[model samples]
Structures are given as C-alpha cells and as structure tokens.
Target: MTALLSFWPLFRRQIGRLGLTLLLSVLTLAAGVALLWVSGWFLTAAALTTAGVSFNLFGPSSLIRGLSLVRILSRYGEKLIGHDATLRLLSTLRSWLFGRLFPRVPLAGRDLRHGDLVSRLTADVDTLDTVFLTAFGPLLTAALIGAGMAAGLFMLLPAAGPIYAATLILALIGVPALLLWLSRRIGAELVEASAALRILTLDRIDGHADLVAFGAMAESDRDFEAATRRLARARRGLGRAGTLAALAVQALAGMALIGTLWCGITALRHGEIDGPLLVGLLLAVLASFEATAMLVRSVGKFGAAATAAQRVRAIAQMRPAITDPKRPVALKQGDLAFNQVTFGFDPARPVLRELSLNLLSGERVAITGESGSGKSTLLALALRLHDPQVGSIEIGSTDIRTVSQADLHAHVALLSQNAPVFLGTLRDNLLIGRAEANDAELWSALEAARIADFVRALPDGLDAFVGEAGRTLSAGQARRLCLARVLLSPAAVLVFDEPTAGLDRETELDFLGDLAAATRGRSVILATHAQIPPGAVDKVYELADGRLSSRPSMRG
Candidate 1:
C-alpha cells in the first residue's frame, strides 16, 4: 500500500489525461452492457409477443449498430489516451530516478554490481508499466461499472439490489485483501529469487574466461540451474494463488447471480416486476462480475510492479557521502597541501595515519612507496575522491572539499593505473581531454607522449581503431595514449599514478622525460615505484611506514 501510494504524485500530475481515458473506457464498457441488455430484451419481447417476431428490425438494428460504433471508437480513444499518459508518467519517473541516482552513485556504500544496476535501470523501470496499464485502468473501470450495476439493479428489483451490492463489495474489498496477504510472502520470495538469478548470471558472464581456464564451467552451470529452479518454484506458487483467487471470485459471482434470479422470479410471480426489467438487471450483474475478474488480475500484476518499484526507490533515495559545498571555492595555480590527514576506506582499518604533505607550484614531485603504502590513496585525496576523517586537502590555499568535483577536475587531470580506453578512433580518444583540439594539436600531443611514430605507422593514422580497452595496442602504447590524453588537457595540475609501469627501462625513461617536459610550468605529482629519470623531477618523496620522507638524489 505504501509503495503504491508513492506513485500517486506522478500519477496525479497526469490525472487529466488519465481521466479522459477512463471516461472513454467507461463509455465503452457501458455501451457493451447496454447492447447485451437491449438485444436480450428485444429477442424475449418478440418471442412473447403474438405478432410472430417480425415487427421493428430497424429500431433494434440501429441500436446495435450505434453500440458497435461506440464500442470501437471508445476503445480506440481509451487506448490512445491511456498509453500516451502512461508513457509520459514513465518518462517523468525515469528522469526523477536518474536525477536522484547521479549524486548517490559516487557515495553509495552497497557493493552494487554493474549488471544489477543495469537491470534496475532497464528491467525494473519497465515492470512499472503494468502498474498503470493493468492496475490503475482496471481498478477505475471496476469501480465505475460496479456502481452503475448496483444502481441499475435497484431500479429493476429493489429487494435484491442491496444483496448484489454487498456481494460486489465483498469481492472487490475482501477477496483482494485476502489475496494480498497470502501473496505478499510469495511475491517477496519471487522477487528475491529473481534478483539472485540476475546476479548469478551476470557473474558467470563476467568471469567466463576465468571459469573456462579453471574448468569450472560445469559447476557454474549447476549453480545457474539451481537458481532457475528456485525461481520456477516461486512462480508456480504464484500461479496456484492466482487460480485460487479466480475460483473464489467465480464462486461469489455464481451466488450473486442465483440469488438475484430467485428474487426476480418471486417478484414476477407476485406481479411486482416485469420480465424485461429483471432481464436487464441480470445482464448488468454478470457484466459487473466480468469487471470484478479483471480487477483481480490487475491487482496481481500490481503486486509484481510494486516489488519492482521498491527496488527503484531504494536506489533513488540514497544520499551521496560527498557533495559540493553550498558556496564552492574556485581553484587557481594547483599548489596542493595535505594537513595532518588520517583516512581509511574503512574506519577500523586506517590507510593513511596523520599523514601530511605539501607541493609547491611548477614543481614535479614523484611519490614512491611499497604496495598498500597509501601512495595512490594520497593521490585520491588530492583528487578529492574521498574526504579524510580528520584533516583537509587543499588546492591553491583552498580546501578541496569546499569546491565542486567538476571544478576540481577542471583544474586537475589524473591518469590512474589502467586508464580507461573507450572504443573509438585514436583521434576520438585523444580529443576527449580537449574536445576542440585540431589535427595538428592531436599529433603534437601524441608525439610529445612518444607514440606519434606508432600512430603514423597504422594505415589510417589517427583514424585507427584502438578496439575495446585498447586490447589491440601494447601495454606501453596504451599507457602513452593515456598520457597523451592528460597532456592535451588544459588543467593546472597533473597527477600520474604508475605511468611508466609495465614498460621497458628505456621506454619508461623516455615517457617520463617527455611528460616532465610537457608540464614544465605546472604542478605534477607522479606516483610510481619505478626509478625516477635523472633531472626528470624537481624533488622525490618516498612514502614509508605511513609517512612522507624526502629522498636524496641517486644520480648525484
């Protein structure tokens, strides 16, 4: 119920459109009921008449034709309006969910898998189509049709009208309440099983290479089969519940029909009611039953859509851990400072302990440390990826936390280990840093990164495809391409994390020398464990035992 209510605001915004659709749907339903009643009345009236059933075909034919036209037109109008309104509502909902999700993604604590997030965005949002198409439409139609049936029954046979109304109320209210209770547990279980299957399938696909190498393909298949079987069992339970609910509704409709007929016969024998009016009442009762059945099916679909809505809401409501200050500070020369910073990815396990450092403008500093010694972590702080628990990171005399992430990145360029290589031409990837860079500027940056000859060697030159993640390129070439990206950017600060990793000594030194020369007038922080090239950096800082210490030049 709470989850259903959450969708009302968006629904209310489109109420005018929904109301128009509902009016058309109701008119269509009413026309069908009237046609059935009038046709039955005419056939019975002619049979009982002494004129041998050949009196007025024109009147009955006209009514039938008009009813048919109304039914078709109303149904067409209803579908057009209903689908248009639903699409608009869905668009609004997806926009709202995306707006809420963007800020939370950088800080969401849950280890959300990429595949799971994709499922939420695509599959989960799509499931909500049933909420409007099935649930809201049928519910509104049932209410209007049930009300009209009750009023028409009273006009025909006053004694039985109350009984018919009570029966309908019970079916509409009591049956749904009972079914909701029973299916709540089953629905929740099915949803969980479905999510588990998604996660397992995605994991298997992502780790396919590893599984094949280890000969664990059969084991993975068994696990997936188990998940599928669990989901099947849950679906079977849901089917059984639906069957039972349908049976209950049908039984109630039978009782209502029988009771109405019995009362009608008594009234007719007592000379208190006519045959035509009783027949009309009976037809309306059956039509109401049809509407009730649709309502039940709609409710079941709503249950499924409600489960999906909850998952989307959970993701859309998460708050980001880091947000720009209301009044953001602008960065200038990129002089960075870390003041007594003590931080950790997890609170109990500290990565940097009261660590502090400072970098002057136009200086090239190389940070070297053992694995897990917080070298990359320090660079992350400079980039403001995570805020420290107790201390501050400042850029050009302003705390980075006081600046927006966009502003921070605008002034600083970071080329981390395993830099992302998108699938596109070499020029496409290089121009990502500076979108307006011309052919000359691109070749210049590529040459400066020591990869111009390699780029020229390709048949298409700058137009050559790098393939996915640059899989076609060698490790050193990929690294140089990433460096070219950073070099092309106009940022004041450049931080390279292991830029020379996985390269030969000569190639590593040449790239380092080129990078240092390219950013001669800017602040550059090179976080690497490789030996620094002679005269490549203004200073060298080694991080050991969770502290930064200056190292004497080995070349001197």
Candidate 2:
C-alpha cells in the first residue's frame, strides 16, 4: 500500500477531474439511499393513516417522487461522468508513461530488459487503472456515504447510530486490514509471476527462430508453462482472499441489521421513536450497506495495485547514463574531439584507455580494428550514449555534457546497426529524421544514399511499407535506407558504425563511394573493420594499443 503513494502526484495532476467523478459517485449513492429511505416512510405513513383517522399524504408523496427521480438521474450521470473522467485520466497517464520510457530504453543486447520494460510500460501501466477506479474512488465514496448515513441515523435515534457506526467501522476498517494483510504477499507474488510470464513469452516469441534452430524449443515451452502456472496460482490465492473479505462484510452487515432492529423495537416499546421513522431507518441501513459492499472487495486490490506501482516507480526512478549540465554551454562550431577519454564496462578491464582523436569539419575519417578493439565504443562515447569515466568529449570547444542533450544531438548524429527501422511506411520512417523535410528533400537524401531509384520504381514509392525492422528489404537496402535517414538530419557530424558490414566487396566499395558523395562537406566518422578505398576518405585510423593509428596496417 505504501508503494501506491508514489502515484499521488500523478493523481493530483488530474485531481479536478477525479474530484468530479467522486462527487458524482457520492450523489448517485446518496440519492439511491434517500429514495429507499423516503419510500419506506411514505408506505408506512400511508398504511397507518388509512387504518386510523386523518394523515397528511402530499408531503410524503412529493418527497418519494422527487427522490425516485433523483435516484434514476443521478445513477445515470454518475456512471457516465465517472467512467469518462477515469478513462481520460488513464489515457493521459499512458501517454506520459511512454514519454518517460522512450529515452530510457537500453540499446545493446536488450532481450530480457526490453521485455521487462514492455511489461511495465504496457500491462503494469494498465494495472494502475485499478488504483483509481477500484481502490481510491470506491473507498472514498463509501466513506463519505457512510458518514452521512451515520449522521442521519444519529439525529433519528441516538443509540442506533452508535451501533451502525460500529458496524461501518468493522466493515470499512477491520475487514480491509485483514484483507490487505492477507493480500500483500499474494498480490506481490502475482505481480512477479505476471511480469515473469510476459517476459518469457516475449523472449520466446522474439527468439523463436533461434530456439527452433538450436533444438531448444522444448525447454522454452516448459519455462513458459511453469510461469503461466505460477501466475494462475497466485490469482487463485488473491481470489480466495477477496471472497473471504466479502463474506466478512456481509456478516458485518447482517449484524448491523439485527442490531438496528433490536434498538428500534426497544425504543418503540419505550415510546422513544415512531413506527414510520423506524421503518425508514431500517430501509436506510439496508440501502446504505449496498454503497459499501463493492468497497470491501476493492480493498484487496490495493495490494495488487501497490505491487504494480512499485515496479512502475522503479523504472520511473532510473537515472539516465548521460544528462545535460545544469548550466549549458553553446557550441559555436561543428568540429568534434575526444580529449584523454577513458572508459570500461567493467572496472578491472578497460575497453578504451586515454583515447583521443579529432574530426575537423568537412573531414572524413575511418576507424578500423579487430572485433574486440573498441571501435564501436569510441563512436558510442562520442555520441554520448555512454559517458567517459575520465575525460571530456567536446564539440566546437564545448564539452558534450555541458550542452543540452537535444543541442548535442542536433550536431552529432550516429547511424549504426543499432538504429531502429520501425514497422511503418517508408515516408513515416524517413520523417523521423526530420519532420519538416519535404518530398523533394527526402528524395534527394535517398538518391544520395543510392536507394532512391529502387523506391521510385515501387508502386507506392514513399508510401511503401517497410515491414518490421525493415525485414522486407535486403541487407544493403536497409543500410542505405538508414544512411538516408541520417542524411536527412541537420547534423554536422555523422558517425556510422559498421555501415556496410555484410555486403560483398564490390558492393561495400560502391556503398563507401556513395557515402563519400552523400556526406560532402560534413564531418564523418566510420567505425568499421572494412578497408576503405583511397579517395573515399581524408584519413584512416585503426584502433590498436588502446588508441588511434596513423600508419596503414593489415593487422586486423
């Protein structure tokens, strides 16, 4: 339950809307109780008056009609308004959560991490609906109605109100305490089991081909089945706890009904209250208990909501690996540089040690190295995907960290194997590079990347769909498309990580030539093991001995 407190800020953001929903719910409940309470008095008074001499009927009849109309109208308004407000809040919350999640996604080797994050952003975010709709909304409405009912009873019969109050407290407080206690562990377990099931399921689906090729499908199936079973078990435990809490509330209601009746009879015998009022009070108790009935079961869901809240809060609280300085420095030019930078994935083994280099504007350079050498890490550091542990990487004499992230990215854009080619149309995917770019500009960039003729020949042209991860295109085609995306950027420094990795030798050289033409007058850093042709680049550097090399070498 404590974990759910983190959502208070989010709730407060929509407090005005939520407050209206709560108001409607209370009005709906109060009107229904009032209708039944007044009807009871009207019927009893009418019967007694018919049996005796003269009795006033107009006042009771008018009140009964008015309350009945209020009950129907308020009920309709309550459901419509309450549901609208809550659904809108959930929609806004989902958008906000995705905004928080987008920049925080881990890029490299993200199998389980991706799955876990998806579960949190999707299912776990959806679970927060329970917090507003099932937990707080119902509970708050029930408390308000209960208090009003208690006060009404106290004015009618002093002793009967105390009895009703005791029962209300037992239903609202005591039963919920037990329900929460019983549900906490089971609810947490349910959340874990659910998240585990989603992750394993996603992992299998994402890696189905590999598992089948390796003859490991049976083991994955078994793991999936086991996770599903655990989730089912936890759900059943929570269901049982919910059932027990409901029964306890029903029992408390029964006690309250019996106690109210006993108090009424004793008071009538002592001439303390009249018969019409007694029947009205009895009916009021019955109708008012209905208002709190759902709340008793809703208490158990607080535990489930708390578990989900903790998971979501965990992700929301994650700090980014790179962030802008409090006071930003504006970069005045496009020259990129690395000054004595050092970094290691593990503290004991360094991948890049005192690595320093420069790429002046309009210069094209290549970094060639063996697989383990850190060519890719150098580009990643320069892109500020990861910060250097020891040195400063600067653009135009301003440290990257001392500049706004958006401003840094505006100058330095990296196109790599890691760049996402989403499931969308070619035009939609290209527009991600620059939203304001026109069709003519897009075609020009694609032509420079050497893929424009192919797209032009297609029936849909820019409207043609690029399947998931651009799987519909060949390896060379996807690379060219990604290059076109970077070409569309307003960046001055363009970094390519293994831009033409798997192409044939002739195609690789042709692609490099195309790249040279496309990147004219822009700073380019190509991190690849492939050898580049003579006139394609200004300088060639190899990653060896933990630094760049000036001399040509066939070591890699």
Candidate 3:
C-alpha cells in the first residue's frame, strides 16, 4: 500500500481528467439509484390511488426518462475520459522508466535478467493501468453514492437510517479490506509467478537452438510445466479469496435490506410512513448496494496492483552507478589519458591498479589481454560508464568526471563485443549512430566497415529490414554492421572492444590492415586479441596483472 501511494505524484498529473471522469461516474450511479427509487414509488402510489383520483404521473415519468438518459450519457463519458487519462499516464510512465533505465545500463551489481526486465517494463506497467481506471475510481464513486443514499434514508425514516449506513460502511470498507489482507501474499505470488513464466518462456525461445542440439527439449518442457503450475496455483488462490469476500458482501446487502424493511413496517403501523414512501426508500437501499458490488469486484485486483507498484518502484528508485557532475565543463578535443587509475566491482579486489596510458590525437593504440583481464573495463572507464576508485581519466586537460556524461559520450564512441543490431530497417539501425547522417555519409561508413557491397546487393538496399539482434545477418555481417554504426558516429575518439570479433581470419586481417586509413583523423583505442598488422597502430600494450607494459609499435 505504501508502494502504491508513492505513485500518487504521477497519478496527480492526470487529476483534472480523472476528477471529471469521477464526477461523471457519480452521476451515472446516482441516476441509476434515483431511477429505481422513483420507479418503485410511482408504481405503488398509482396502484393504491382509486380511479378518477388526480395523482400526477407526468412528473415521475419525465424524471425516469431524464435519469435514464443521464445514466447512459454519463456512463459513456466516464469510460471515454477514464481510459484516455489512464493511457496517457501509462505513456508518461514508460518514458520516465526508460529515462531511469538508461543511466543504470549494465545495471552493475543487479541480477536483473533481460526477460525479467522486459516483464517489468511491459506487463507490470500494464497492470498499473488498473490502478485508477478500475480500482481508485470505483472505490471513490461507490463511497459517494453510498453516503448520498444513506443521507436520504436518514431524512425520511429515522430508524432505518443507521441500519442502512452501518450495513453500507461494512460492505464498502470491511469486506474489501478483509479481501486485500487475505489476498496480499497471494497477489504478490501471482505477479511473481506470471513474471517468472514470462521470463522462462523468453529464455527457452532464446535458447531453443541449443536445447534442440543438446536433446534437452524434454527437460525444457518439464521446467515450463512447473512454471505454469505455479502461476495457476497463485491465480486459483486469489480467485478463491475474492469469491469468499464477494459472498460476504452479498450477505451484508441482504441484512441491510431486511433491517430496513422491518423498520419501514413498524413505522407504517405507527402512521409515521406510507406504503409508497417505504417501498421507495427500500428500493433505493437495494440500488445503492450495487455500488458496493462494483467496489468489491475492483478491490479484488487491488492487492495485485499494489504488489506491481512495489516491483516498479524498486527499479525507479535505484541510485544510478554513475551521474553527471553538478557543474560540468565542456569537453574539448585533446589527448585521451588514463592516469594511475584503479577500479574493481568489489573494492577489496581491484581489477586495474595504478594504470596509466596516453593516446595523442590521431594516434591509434592497441591493448591486448586474455579474457577477464580488465581490457573491457579499461574502455568502459574511458567512456565513463563507471568512474575509477582512485586517479582520473582525462580528455586533454579536463577530467572526464568533471564533464557531463552526454558531453563525454559525444566525444568518445565505443563498439563493445556484444553490440546489438535493433529490429528495424538497415537504414534505421545506422541512423542511431547519427540521427542526421545523410545517405552519402551512411554509405561511406558502410564502405569503410567493408559491409557496403552486401547491403547494396539486397533488393531493399538501405531500407532492408533487419531482424531483432541481427538474426537475419550472419555473425560476421552483424559485427561489421555494428562497426559501421560506430564508424558513423562523429566522436573524435573511437574505442573498439574486440572490433574484429566474429569475423573470419581473412576478413579480420583485412580490417586490421585498413585500420589506419579507415580512422585517419581520429584517435583509436582498440582492445583485442587479434594480431595487429604492420602499420595498423602506432603502439601496442599487453595488459597483465592489472598493469600495462608497452610493446614497440609495429607501425612504419
């Protein structure tokens, strides 16, 4: 519940539209109660009045017609405005989540799987759409309608008023509260089970090829079945709890009606109320309980909504691993240097210790090391994905930390080993590097990366659609396409982490041979295990034991 309240600020942004929707909802339900109340009174009065007795039928008939119209129109307006506001809120929520997600990329120290992250972004966010549309709106409207009916009864029948009010308060608050309590754990389990099922499904699909190759399809099936059973059990538990609460509410409504009827009968014997008026008030009481039934149905999902809110808030509230300086200095082009830097995921065990290196402008340098030797960590530090615990990385004279991340990133472009090719057109994938890059510039980048001929051979040329993760392209083709993207970036310093990875030996050698010409005017920091060709770089350093020992340049 506390987690759900945290989102009130975001919810308040749509308050105007939501408030109007709430008003229309009240009108719709009020008209329904009034329609029933007036109908009962009119019918009874007409039946008792003798022939030729002047009892006005026109006023009641007109009111009934007007109320029916109001109910129909208000109900329509309520749905239209309510759905619109909820959708807008969801849209804003997605954008805000993405903003929070970007700075936390690589999500260090978090065990968040890709599929689980997808579940939170999609299904969990969709669940919150019910927060206002079904839950809060219905609860508030029911309370208002219940109070109005109770007040009317108090004015007419003094004895029945307290009974109806007490019954209603119990039905509206007590039953739903009990349901939420009993189903809180069940609801949270249901959400987790559903996300687990989604994660497992996606994981299996992603690893289907390996599963088939290993003849483990049967094992995968068993795992999937277990997940489905967990989800089913959670759903059944929540449904059972809701069903019992609903029955309790029905029982309360019955008690209210019987108590009101007994009071009305006694009043009639004492000549305190007429049959028509008593019947009218009794029908109104029944109509008002309709609101409680709606409230019960919506509140059944409240526990799940609250749990979903907590899951989403957990992600949004995480402190980013890195942030921009309070007052950022503008980045300027100069030598890229890492001076006496030391960093590690765990402070007790450092990965890079007192490492220092410098690459003058337009100079290409290669750093080679075995896997897990912090070669990738070096590039990440340069990009400011994570700052070093001690010492500073500088671009010219400015400490990279003193500049905005956006500014630092704008000057340094990195192509990591696992770079992805998004689902879009070939042109669309390239445009991510430089949104305003012209066709000529894109073609030039592709040519430099040596993937231009393959792209041109396609029927759609640049417009050819690429599958998600570049599944449509071979490993080598995807690698080169990503390389083209980095090459297309306007950054002065280009950092490549295993840039020649995934390519055949022949293609790899050609890429290394042409490295100098391809990045003529920009400084290149290449981290790789590939053999560097003569003239490929001005210098090479092999990283061992968290230190760099420079090897003489192979360049002419």
lDDT of 2 by residue, 1-556 (tens): 6668867877787787678778878887888888778888878877877555467678877887887787688767767776776677688768777677556654343333777877887877777864777888888888899999999888888788888999999888888888889999998899889889988988998999999999999999899999999999999999999998888888888888888889999999999988988898898898888867878778877777888888887776666556678998886786888999888776467788898898899998889889989988898888788887889998888888888878878888889866778799999988888999999999999999999999998899999998999998887888888889999999999999988887888888888877778999899998887777767778888888678878552321
Candidates sorted by lDDT, best first: 3, 2, 1
> Which candidate number would show the highest lDDT if scored against the true structure?
3
Clashing pairs in 1: none
| Model 1 spans with C-alpha error above 4 angstroms | 52-54, 111-116, 215-219, 270-273, 326-332, 364-376, 413-490, 496-522, 526-556
Instruction: In model 3, state the lDDT of residue 532.
Output: 90
Scanning candidate 2 in windows of ten residues, the lowest lDDT window is: 103-112
The Cα local distance difference test for each model comes to 0.83, 0.83, 0.90
Model 2 steric clash pairs: none
What local lDDT does model 1 show for residue 28?
87
Worst 10 residues of 1 by lDDT: 105-114
* Model 3 TM-score, 2 decimals: 0.87
Candidate 3 yields a Cα-based lDDT of 0.90
Clashes of each: 0, 0, 0
RMSD of 1: 4.6
- How do the candidates rank by TM-score, highest first? 3, 2, 1
Instruction: Tell me the spans in candidate 3 whose CA falls farther than 4 Å from its real position.
Output: 42-66, 208-227, 270-272, 423-431, 436-481, 504-514, 529-535, 549-556
- Give the top-scoring candidate (TM-score): 3
- Candidate 1 — what's its lDDT? 0.83
